[model samples]
Target: MNGEGKVVCVTGASGYIASWIVKLLLLRGYTVNATVRDPNDKKKTDHLLALEGAKERLKLFKANLLEEGSFEHAIDGCDAVFHTASPVTLTVVADPQAELIDPAVKGTINILKTCTKVSFVKRVIVTSSISTVMFPRSPLGPTDLVDETTFSDPSLCEEKKLWYVLSKTLAEDAAWRFANANEIDLIVMNPGLVIGPILQPTLNFSVDVIVNFINGKNFFNRRYHRFVDVRDVALAHIKALETPSANGRYIIEGPIVTTNDVEKVLREFFPDLCNDDKREDIDMITKTYKLSVEKVKSLGIEFTPTETSLRDTVLSLKEKCLI
Candidate 1:
């Protein structure tokens, strides 16, 4: 077995993407230590316990991102650690420092601190967002291509009040600084606006982007939807860990679609769910910069098509009664 006898710890294992990572880890025959805010919250964890190998191989630990030494129990005996816990609000937050920044930056530092104390740990993979790379200081031209090399401007993020982006940018920055100073092998997975079927009952921010359109909310104007399936993102994390030469950051993204493109696909497959009146506000000709995925593709990921992802998303939403 690929993961036989190997133990891994995934922080925020009950989240939108981390849940899938836990599921994938279990299926690979790995012993998994999953950390969440409240391990006994059945509403947040029932789906995780029901996974294929959960009963035998999965253990849930309670952890607080802001509290020091909270992650020690979960990460102590693990071979690798996946740090995926971070606030992901896309809307205006009442307290950016407490609600967004502290948890993200402090949580990362705490995890790395714990990782340093443990000798058995070999690698740490952090889940970051393309926002840290794509949100440049200046406006990007339509022909511009974004890759792993670009870092988002912290000052610019603060200027625009992009709290979520700023949080991710700063957190990833903290992770790299800690990893480098401690000589810990670190790999970062930067995924773009993740969307796919939901395993957790509650709707996440990324999934809400699709739900907004179904509910007749015209949230898009000059925006582009850079999407990657949740499953693919999970798989990418494992691939990064398993691959010997996998180093630095990988931008895990797929087809870049615009508001017009989104409306066209939704209308074609989900005509009843889409409101035609709301789509009139969409700007078809506004182009967005493309993301470079060649680095991630080197790991042999053939990304799921955009239409397939959208169809599966709607089907899952309907099944969950969330649409």
Candidate 2:
């Protein structure tokens, strides 16, 4: 497919990862038709508008996750569509299903329906979470290798109250079903907890985990988290778009860092701000889980170092006064 002057659409254009994908696409000379819930909201669209080459190549459209046919206009004339819109909140809301399920599963199907109508679309990349593959109820040991074939049992997710995990698993399942039924090319990316610098003013859910750690909250539940820089995830999307042989699902985890590893980085970055008194007593033997990177690595994607990713993320938080 031609990259020059190609039109591409991205849902949730204002989101953390989606914003980076848009930045990369615009830099690569692709005309981006980006969708947000409200195009009139200056806070969401401002960063996107200021992106390089956005003046001539970017177009913003208002689209709702629950609204059918809302994303039709945005993705209609595109060669590829990146569906990155999903609820990232981890807290147990009053209406967990509505807050997580409907928007993720139903919204994915809505985009696929629109893409089916748009004849120009050659590829559809859906942003699924690593939660879809990892068994949150029983995390794997350090040596365990999680790949595309592994899936979080949906029943297990429901029984274990893993709403966010359930949302992604269901959404990706529905997308694959729709793609198969319509004979469309679909590639799903299950990225582990995404980290890195902020292109937006507010903090995302993934970054908020780090913030919460600094706040000395939820330490009793401390465990290892696999992080993939958002920029690398965006590049993987581009790689999948370009690789004709790429199919099925791909795990996008970069490095696995334990909670103690995280605290060490925090202390190193901000000694004064991080209160030792408030810090949680990290376990001597932290349980760690790992994701297999063989699939995405086959496409030649290199990830940012764990230490560098953490340092830059904290520095960026400090720069934005979020720390």
Model 1: how far residue 29 lies from native, Å = 0.8
Deviating ranges (above 4 Å) for candidate 2: 136-143, 218-220, 273-290
lDDT of 1 by residue, 72-152 (tens): 999999999999999899887999999999999999999999999999899999999988897778777678888888999
Model 2, 18-45: lDDT tens per residue? 9999999988889999999989999899
The TM-score between candidate 2 and the true structure equals 0.92
RMSD of 2: 2.7
Alpha carbon lDDT of each predicted model? 0.88, 0.85
Model 1 misplaced stretches (Cα beyond 4 Å): 274-286
Best lDDT among the predictions, by candidate number: 1
Backbone steric clashes in candidate 2, count: 0
